[model samples]
Target: MAFSVDSTLKELLADERAREVLRKHLGDRSNDPRINMVLYLSLRTIASFPEAGISQEKLKAIDEDLRKL
Candidate 1:
């Protein structure tokens, strides 16, 4: 599957490369228990939440990495 910012968290997490990209950008937060609650949400949706701590720059970096996979 082609992964992008619009990809759901579950879809990204299902791919090891995508998971690594998320880990690189989000650190421990990528594995947080709360992540389960948003698995069905798109990266774009989650990034929109200020509490998610994902700045637009970070999201861009993540999108770039995901594209490489």
Candidate 2:
């Protein structure tokens, strides 16, 4: 799970479009705790959104993945 998370985040950062999308939110925070907090806050935001943009099952999977880590 750690590897998957690491690789996925790497992929996101490696892609120009995704990196551009995330650069403002990511800034210079490259540490684990900061990254984890970002993930938590992002999920919290998505979970509370009025419009159903993200699926509940996907959110559950993210929770499960974080628990595994």
Candidate 3:
């Protein structure tokens, strides 16, 4: 779960606009260890629920893919 969350966070962080926003909010310290930790933690805090309000079939498909991993 942590790896999945961290990977997702890494993807989000790779986006230029998202990185800029973090840089702005963290005041040029987004790369700092404490700030990175806080951001990663908050990413999980704000993440959508597992099912993400999707249909059962879609959820099942996602589950299947996750199981493959």
> What are the models' TM-scores?
0.90, 0.33, 0.33
Local distance difference test values of all predictions, in order: 0.90, 0.45, 0.43
Candidate 1 stretches with Cα past 4 Å from truth are none
Which structure is stronger by TM-score: 1 or 3?
1
Worst 10 residues of 3 by lDDT: 1-10
Candidate 3 lDDT over 1-69, as tens digits, reads 322223444554666654554343334554456545444443434335452233445434433433333
Most accurate candidate by lDDT: 1
What tens digits encode model 1's per-residue C-alpha lDDT throughout 1-69?
889999999998888888889889988576477988999999999999999999999999999988888
Question: In candidate 1, how many Å is residue 7 off?
Answer: 0.6
lDDT pick, better of 1 and 3: 1
Which of the numbered candidates is closest to the native, going by highest TM-score?
1
Query: Where does candidate 3 stray beyond 4 Å?
Result: 1-7, 34-69
Number of clashes found in candidate 3: 0
lDDT digits (tens) for residues 1-65 of candidate 2: 23222334554445555454344333444554545534434443534555524466654554454
